[model samples]
Target: MISWQARALNLFLKQTVKRSIENTKDVNKLRFQMRALDKFVFGTSSNIERSQSMREGTLCDEIKLKFSNSKKKLLYVHGGAFVFKTPAIHNNFIARLAEPLDLHAIVPDYPLAPEYPFPAALDSCYVIYKSLLDAGTLPEDIIIAGDSAGGNIALSLLLRARRNGLPMPNCCVLISPVADMTQSGLSSVENRYSDALFSLDVMLYCRNLYLEGANHDLHNEEISPLFADFTGLPPFMFHAGSTELMRDDSTRLAEFMQAHGVETHLQVWREMPHVFPLFEQLPESKAALQQIVDFIKKQQN
Candidate 1:
């Protein structure tokens, strides 16, 4: 059953997000609306102790916690539909997930779109991963993760690394990832009204902003990891709200990976909204985080 807090959040999104998207026609105006609402959406919780800083020119936050001398680390990318900036909630969830395992989450604030465009964010992420490997961080000890657009970036980063023959991460954890920028998934249309946080119009607007008049092919594997070869990639654990518009993105990517003999697991939470794992107050979210924790631990073993 969905928690009351989730339901209330749904209602709030219906009133604020849906209404704002419905009224705003221009992409810039929509982005403005989202930015205003993002303030409330990014509020920090009392439970997590996080501090932000700049590392290798990438904005990141370190969660204050002590763990054994394990060298396990995490690269958690934040999601904002390619335009919206990272908020405190991203840091909070990363801390919650990493603190328990003594995993250090390095969240890089990659470039946003409509300004930096498609390859900019991807390039930034790739460089960060490469830097980790260069700094003697074993690829097998690092966990690459992200949610929504960030999830998309996480997958693309692996694909880029694999194509260039770089070491792969130990595992990947994705929450409601936009695996396909083409937005061709059935759930994208079917779950429009069901997904409280996203809509077809809203996604298209974000897509256009990310593309930025570039002639890039949306179906390109780098743009959409759904089209990429998953062979030799690390194991993947995907979490998505059943009602989310991007639910099929997870399913499709899972099927593709499994078909290619890659280890993959997809967990669907009933009636939950996009990236429900961020709702640390909800029981379901806690359960979901535990699932990820177990997945990562299994990778370590």
Candidate 2:
């Protein structure tokens, strides 16, 4: 059974949010709405200490620099079906990563649909990642992390980095990534009613907007990293809400990573939705945060 919070979330979805699911139809309006959310979501601080600034014309969320020990830099990507959300909207979420790891983080707003499209989001993120290397960040101090679409981006960035001979991050963490964009995964359909937040139709709609003309088949591995080659990734840790739609993405990806000789850890939180650890204001969210903090600490060793 879904929790009371989940039930209320679903009701909100059916009423107000369900309507916006159709935001795919008007890309401009969608961007406008996202801009409004960015005020609260993008520009929001990672709440960490460090020199901070915002850079735009890149991707979805404006870039943010959260200070830390100054030497260690963690790069973060925020997920919104590759359509909605920015760095600020995910500040509370990304900031938690900083809290546990005590590392500086750079989150760039990658490009989104219709206006920017697939290669747009992908390329923009790649650029910022490459910038880190150009700026002389050591491979060991760099950790890549993301939730949902950001998770997918994090994986994609790892693959691209490896393939291009850029130093792979020392580790990566994904929170409920969308690995099989084709939506062909059994969980994509089976877990539909399970996750309190995501709807398959809504995901399909967002996928449609992203891959509209490009790969019609999101399972192509470029859009979804499940089929991508992750042969030489760094150490990793991931968490998934058992009832969440993207749980399998984390599990399956972990299996693949381990199979490929990458040290990996996977945590499954029962009856929760995608990245519930991020909702730290709530009870479950607090417990979830502590677990992730522990995981990151382990990797620190």
Candidate No. with top lDDT: 1
Query: lDDT per residue, candidate 1, 1-301, as tens digits?
Result: 6789888888887788777786345767666766675555344435445667776677776663553455777888889888886465677688777667778778887888877998888888888889889999999889999999999999999999998989999999999998898888999888988888777887877888888967888888878889988999999999998888999999999999999999999999998888889867677888999999999989999
1-301 per-residue lDDT for model 2 (tens digits): 5467655544554454435544356556555655654553223344554344544345333232443345676788888888887545476666665665667767776767756777777777787788878888888777788888888888887788788899887777778888887666567778877666656776777777777666356566667799876777888888888877787888888898888898988888777766666554346666666776676667667
Angstrom error of the Cα, residue 261, model 1: value is 0.8
lDDT (Cα) of model 2: 0.70
Q: What CA root-mean-square deviation does each model show from the true structure?
A: 2.3, 3.7
Clashing pairs in 1: none
lDDT (Cα) of model 1: 0.84
Error of 1 at 284 (Å): 1.2
Stretches > 4 Å off in candidate 2:
1-69, 216-219
Error of 1 at 61 (Å): 2.3
Give the 10-residue window scoring lowest on summed lDDT in candidate 2: 59-68
